[model samples]
Target: MSRRSTRAARPAGAARPAGCPCGLPEPYDACCGRFHAGAAAPTAEALMRSRYSAFVQANAAYLLRTWHPRTRPDRLDLGPGTRWTGLEILAVRDGSAFHTTGTVTFRASFRGGSLHERSRFERVDGAWAYLDGEFPD
Candidate 1:
């Protein structure tokens, strides 16, 4: 089976709660949902948060689409049992609406553990795209 299929299935068209999975105070529709529906994220931090939400929802298409094409993987597998729990934005640098490049450091908690990484983003075609990340020691 495809790794994507191994993930827990969410009910199709299920109504999501007002709060977004990315730990943002705003509703899903007002936050990451708009990004998933084709609106470009205004800043790198917004893209990072929305990417976290996509992972939580197992939305691989959104993940791939938002990834920088040059570094994007041939395919993605949301491997089984990795339940994303929460996100905490630690810092952001340069990646504003006017900046072409930026970085976001965040802590993302999951069922088994948490990941702390500084992710890099760049604007491609006037939209923010995830480039890569580094795990802090």
Candidate 2:
């Protein structure tokens, strides 16, 4: 006999989650949504997570706003068909509130493949901003 437990039926009053695309246990609104709404991310990892969520939500304005002005592009094109699937934070360094600069190493998976980037971040105007990145082999 199989020991697998069957699923329990939910009450009609129960709300279902579409799930936060950022891979966090919390819902989108509680997690990355605050950052998209203009709240500054407290850490470099937080900014990186919110940035990943932004890509998933296609909030180009938020992405642009969090990017450093010196390195920010003139325009952003998210493309038509690329779908981001998941985000995995690999490493972090010096990105705390006490530091003015930091880096986050992460893997962002998509429909076809994944992007591995060591993204640099710096404080601009007292807020953390994406500065640039390097692709490591």
Candidate 3:
């Protein structure tokens, strides 16, 4: 069997906590929540943060929507037992209002360990979408 690391989905109308899972100082409603609620992220970093928040919440729809069409999978399967703990952005390249493409390196921690990747992003229809990533050696 092939193991897949995909995003999950949050339950309907769940009460938000004091802060965003993205680790931003702002509250959930003010930070990544806005992106989850339909607002477009302004930069690649913003999109990356929001995506991390989505993973933490198991919001598969949001993750898929922000994925580049060329790379998006037909379905997501976030490990049912996985528990996301936090996110930390390590680096970034271009990906902004002025740039069509950009890259963000980050580490996403969970119960046991963490995932590290340098993700790529590009604009599609004027909105940033996740393209792909590479694991550093």
Residue-level error in angstroms, candidate 2, position 8: 20
After superposition, which runs of candidate 1 have C-alpha atoms over 4 Å from their true positions? 1-18
lDDT of 2 by residue, 37-121 (tens): 8788998888999999989888899999999999999889996688998787778888998999999888899999999999999
Task: Judge candidate 1 against the unseen true structure and give its global Cα lDDT, from 0 to 1.
Answer: 0.88
Output the worst ten-in-a-row residue range by lDDT, candidate 2: 1-10
Give the alpha carbon lDDT tens digit for every residue of 8-95 in model 3: 4558897544677887768989999999999999999999999999988899999999999999999999988999997878787888
Better of 2 and 3 by TM-score: 3
Off by over 4 Å in 3: 1-17
- Give the local distance difference test score of model 2: 0.86
Q: Per-residue lDDT tens digits of candidate 1, residues 35-118?
A: 999999999999999999999999999999999998999999996689998888888888887899999988899988999999
Cα error, residue 40 of model 1, in Å, equals 0.4
